[model samples]
Target: MAIAVAATRQVLADSYKTLSGASTVWVSLHTGDPGSTGTAEASGGSYARVQGTWTSGSGGSLSMAELTFNAPSGSFSYAGLWSAATDGTFYDKCALAPSITLGSAGTIKVTPSFSVS
Candidate 1:
């Protein structure tokens, strides 16, 4: 499937003002493609938030963040950013490279970057 590369209009607006300062940000893994809607939540099969360090990116070039799933479960082809740590609005979507498969061991890292030009 083709990758859906779009951030929410609200996210784009808030991102410039106070999105970076939002508390309890989270990144979730998704097997379902973002499609045209470009929004989704992790409340179904094999979907869960990765437990890792979420380093918010700095600078006016790009508002980005990195997530390293210490013990990511299942498999996913896409990733998303949420405002709340759990059960929040999906602000952005990203299709992973080569997909991510979590087995018995190892870690999964996903770096989602945002830029406006």
Candidate 2:
């Protein structure tokens, strides 16, 4: 089988200002049951991180650079904390590293840089 490097577009809200190249950081989403209670993707859960870059400005597209899956043992810390909601704190559904460093690109679509496992 062949592995493909791809990702979907992640848009930025007006409040976020905009998405830039290497400016934003996000994690990958895995396929499987979230498991039992407290088995969320970033909360005491397992996930992977895919590094990439955005070519354009704050509203263009994302170009992946690399990917890594580093699952923590217990507890979890998302990129940013939600103002009102705690569950929506994480930026990426699947995560390992701290965050992706968006480049000069402001905002654009995003995708995986390589084959993520």
Candidate 3:
């Protein structure tokens, strides 16, 4: 049986609260699918995960504040959400609509939105 809409909304709301309440939530840039272990994370040339702030979930949806990354010279195809700046917990990942490519001295800014139905 499928989950009820109200139940789904509750689940998403609870999840949003948990994720946003974490001491720090990090947004990571990825060259490919981060996979289960968050592999393929971007590295080198000032690449680092940026901390994210999230808006309150409503109707089973929420959005992350804009994240700015001083990315290295490469192509990024995905983004991952983590529990910490370094190696902590890997929450989830999503593919970029139009993957990002940077030459030298580039910056990528993204505002991620999430929803569950």
Candidate 4:
């Protein structure tokens, strides 16, 4: 199974929950039509609600990379969720509405089983 933990408002701590095998799941947003483009959508199009959980992995936590996908290469607005529990998902500890601007570079380090990748 997948897991999530909250750190802050604009960051999300996700865990692939990988034990012996790597987990793979699709991410969806609740805005645009997730059509024609399969799971991922084209630019500007609204996305479906962000769904699915990544199993807790080595880097069990990750601050949803802000603006990592922003630029001429992958320009788009994205929403994120934050949780507090190492495997919290039942409720949202915090919510990241939507961000599309160029974000400042920073880092968040998770210990024991997680870190910035």
- Clashes per candidate, residues 3 or more apart or on different chains: 0, 28, 0, 24
Candidate 3, position 32, lDDT: 91
TM-score, every prediction: 0.55, 0.28, 0.86, 0.22
Give the per-residue lDDT of model 2 (tens digit) for 1-117.
Answer: 322322212232222322322344444332232333223443223344333333332332333444344444433322221211223333333342544332322221234422121
lDDT of 3 by residue, 1-117 (tens): 534686677576667647646524788999998888899999998889998866656667677778899999999999998888899888888899899999875899999877666
Q: Write the per-residue lDDT of candidate 4 for residues 8-109, one digit (tens) a residue.
A: 311333433332133322232212332333323323422223323453433335323222221232323322222321222322112123423323322211
Distance from true location, Cα of 59 in model 2, Å: 10
Worst 10 residues of 2 by lDDT: 77-86
Stretches off by above 4 angstroms in model 1 are: 1-17, 20-24, 34-60, 63-65, 71-73
Where does candidate 2 stray beyond 4 Å? 1-22, 28-39, 42-53, 57-60, 71-88, 91-117
Q: Can you tell me which runs of candidate 4 are displaced by over 4 Å? A: 1-16, 23-67, 73-75, 79-96, 101-117
RMSD values, in order shown: 7.3, 12.8, 2.2, 12.6
Q: Which candidate wins on TM-score?
A: 3
lDDT of 3: 0.82
lDDT for residue 112 in candidate 2, whole number 0-100: 43
State candidate 4's TM-score: 0.22
Candidate whose lDDT is highest: 3
Would you list the rank order by TM-score, best first? Answer: 3, 1, 2, 4
